[model samples]
Target: MSATVADEGTAPAGTRTEAVQALRVPVSRSYRFELVKLVSQWRIRLLMLVCWLVPGLFVAAVSLQSTLPTDTLFGRWMHASGWAGPLVVLGFAGSWALPLLTSVVAGDVFAAEDRLGTWRHLLVAVRSPRRIFAAKALAGLTVILAMVAGLVASSAVGGLLSVGDQPLVGLDGHPLASSDAAGHVLLAWLCVLAPTLALAGIGLLGSVVLGRSPIGLLLPALLAVAMQLAQMLPLPVALRLALPGYAFIAWNGLFAAPAQLGELLIAVAVSLAWAVAATVSAYLLFVRRDFTNATDDGLGRRALWVGLLPPVGLLALGFGAVAAAAPSTTGSGITQAKVERSVATSFAHLYRLQTEQLHRPAVTEAQLRTTATCDRSDGQVDPTGPGNDWRCVVTWHLPGAAAPGNAVYQLDVASDGRIEADGDGPKEVNGYFLVRSAHADAPNPLWQFDGDVELLPTSPKG
Candidate 1:
């Protein structure tokens, strides 16, 4: 009896060791099997093909279009400098196509097994539901990553081949040197993928909760579109925090002058949160739910609502926040006028200094005038010599005041180079003049003119 008991104990130990060894093998083996099954599906193969071919087609179409002028919208959009090239394209795809593609794989991952009546067999043969869920999630994510990689690679390749290497101009009209811009474009594409992972998780959750292949595949895409539309509503600032769209806007950092890291970090965090929550919840629901009754509708209503609510609430809250934070337009127009006047006055002073130093003739009078409130002109004697001639005209608008009437001033310089300032204006108004140099294409050399001006009050009360 002792020998028989020892034999049984040894046998169980050996079996347990073998089980542990099997578990120790790389988890990827299970994922690989899932991947093989996924690739074999007709829908997946079609999606892969579409992802590759569509970008090529778009590149070809864009290449055929005539080159646009620098200022033209199409030119700016296609050029490297414009956000249109990489960030815009990637954002557009992430917001719509990536989610749709991920949903296709995730939605069908588990649901297809049920639809084909393979779930029962799968459960029996698969050792653990957790392991199966892990493998399936891995497979779905792998597919998404592959799709994103293909699209990014093809688009970059196509863009390079079609648009020869050129310094990309930035949104602020500054040129981004060729070498640096290329690196930024690549980085931007990678950052865009961060958000799509959450989209994959969302689709995965939908697949588990709905247990219907079609619902799983389409719901995430629909949800993305719905969120996008809802984010447009006038909402409070805090609510925007919940929007997926906000994550997308974070991509703007990649194109910023110094590169905005703060917003990008926030987006990365939010995206990861969405992915983890969706995936964990999906796993929990799948493990706890009964699969024994194949005839019973796959998911209960409660599970569906649980899966759907978080993202929906996030969307609504985001929309409300954005609307609330928008600027109120109480006195925007008046404020704008004041700001414009300040900028114009600064420009006038700078122009006057440059012309006086560069030109031979000295300015005699400078006159500033406005039709509605105040108008004035003035001239100054040439300190250097009597022969030098100088004259100027200045137009200005008061703070929070409408633009005044048209005012003109002319100057006559005598043979000796002395400027005799004579213009239609009061002596006090014409005492000092603002002078500006003539444009390169002007009719005469040393052309002088009055700078346009606006008088702004020193304080808001004025």
Candidate 2:
């Protein structure tokens, strides 16, 4: 039997086994062709341009500024993330621009075929609706990913160049160690891509349902705006779950101190689920729908409008509810003044203790006018009150043991009664001072001291 099988294998080339072996062929390399088509599209090129250029321009302008407040949370975040500022700027954009950018590509992908009446030609040439659907979907995903990459890279480079490599300080007013912050910034950038994919899927679904490039493009953008509006409502948790724009805000947790992974995971899962559903719906509809020509069916148009209007109406209702429920702030200024007064009173007591501790007998109350402005020989005068002069100014002279001149001691009090001092002689303590008010209605003692004081060159001279 073995010898007979061997003989059959070695049989003439025209035999069935030999013919079967020869029939096997390699799979067609259509994915590469699809990618080429995607890359060649003008819309894809425009996305790439915006991703790179917009970030670069914004970073360049910011970098040229003579000063940037290092104290602010956002400013510190920008400084630490380096070029990530422009990319972070995308969070602001994703609220609108990203949705529009995504829609531009997604909405046009399938709708363009219907508009140009090329659906029939593509279907016949491709010979597989499944492959055609996958190609278009992948092309849209590829464009989005490419734009994300460009935006991240450009923003990183631009920020690093424009803003120096500073350690990131977090929103909670704590510093992020350099290595830790860089990783977080990169991860945050990547996390944003998840929602972008979901946005793309929405646009693709719109394209499939609308069968017109204009509607497909505008639909996703409009939906994003609608979702944003809806998110403002005190809606049921389940209803909020249905909206996509919520994921963008959820991304901010990536920069949190403990790093909110649970919210991020939920966002990722929700976005992925939405993407899958939209892609599946688009695929099934594109494959089954009759697209013999560019002409729109009334039924298809009605479906598109019906699908679009519900979300829009919900959003409008949400906006109305929010507008009506917003708090009135007409009396806020008076409320703010009362709060400020409470703070001021609490700060006065601590200032009195600090001033009494620094006093010297050589620094006479008359020469050391706790109220007079001390004109340093260097031309710097210590102002005495909070209104740019000094909140509380205390001046005293230090008598020198061996020197011809007495050293000056000047303490300028801020409106908050925090004391700052600068002088010719060494002071034991320097920098900001804190004060607590002894009582609510009691006068601030530090406020009683004059701005100027003179110390005797010697105690005998005084």
Candidate 3:
């Protein structure tokens, strides 16, 4: 990582500049230093322990469950296959758990020097804040990547040992042979890694801005919390489509027969974009700022405040603008047939999954026979492609039940073609719970099983 000093005596002014730059020391050296520090830190040591141990424990606990948990994307497969265990843990990891994992190191790296009042001493030894920031950020990212790897490996191993490597089912309920399932599960874990890096970048930005450990940690965690909350809010589908974390759903599509390649690309692009932007901004701030806390002039204080607020403020304004400008009911090019077909196909696929949990006689997709007519609203709106204002009167029959009357589904479709549907169907339209199978002992798998299915009609008919 060391750079050789340039010979300035026989060289031009540019060479002198190169020499000066070369004398600045390598960022890799800083990275190595940070890595050593991370390994030595007691809290980090504890975090590593938790990361490896928790997955094994979680998988073990899930193994004891008696019934399929049909709620999550891969919950039913939890006990059915070891592959499902990591996917399930991935769902939980995206929450507060992930932020804490990345932020703990990122948020503390830069800010710790300021908090400990060791900037003067550290700078004397460390050359520049640029090198320090690079090393710390690299170390944080490395730690997070390791944690992600550990969790995936441990969860998969734990599930295999405890649950047995049964045939893993895709999100669409298509059965994947045990051999092919391992690759898909690994890919799913890889897909989840994007947001982890993005969160780390955010943590770095927060740490540099706050100049303290706790606040640095808290800011990124709070942002993560806020994003999760925003995802749950009843907002315009188009606006939600722009959200950074919304890309997480794209991973669910990976478990499908034909993994949603378009969604996966978009998700990775958006998440990586966020990560890059945050990392660059953090690096710029860390490199340029006067961490000595000495104001060269009256404006230095003002400049600091301006620097800190503008990025955050602009981000906030951007999100607000999109939400405000978007229509409550965005237009779509979808037709009645398209809507009906997607709902019918997805419903039958999911409901059959539900019925399996309920221990009912097997039913075919043809048997469900979903009949529905969709209306875009009373305003003569054309439901051509995607819209949040569409409603469908769906009638489908199940075995051993009275001829049920019509059920209604109110649908909201995102610009990305993801659907958020609410309806008066028995249980929930999507992510509905099914009664556990008879003679199951431990926790039922299908209990309160809610699922996610992002719909972009596979076949559209006129």
CA lDDT of every candidate: 0.55, 0.53, 0.65
Locate the minimum summed-lDDT window of 10 residues in model 3.
443-452
Alpha-carbon runs more than 4 Å astray in model 1: 1-26, 67-75, 79-84, 309-462
Best-matching candidate per TM-score: 3
Candidate 2's displacement at residue 159, Å, is: 0.7
lDDT of 1: 0.55
What's the ranking of the predictions by lDDT, best on top? 3, 1, 2
Clashes of 1: 46
Model 3 Cα shift for residue 452 (angstroms): 4.2
Model 2, C-alpha of 252: deviation from truth (Å): 1.5
Model 3 compared with the native: what TM-score?
Answer: 0.72
lDDT of 1 at 393: 39
**Total backbone clashes of model 2?**
23
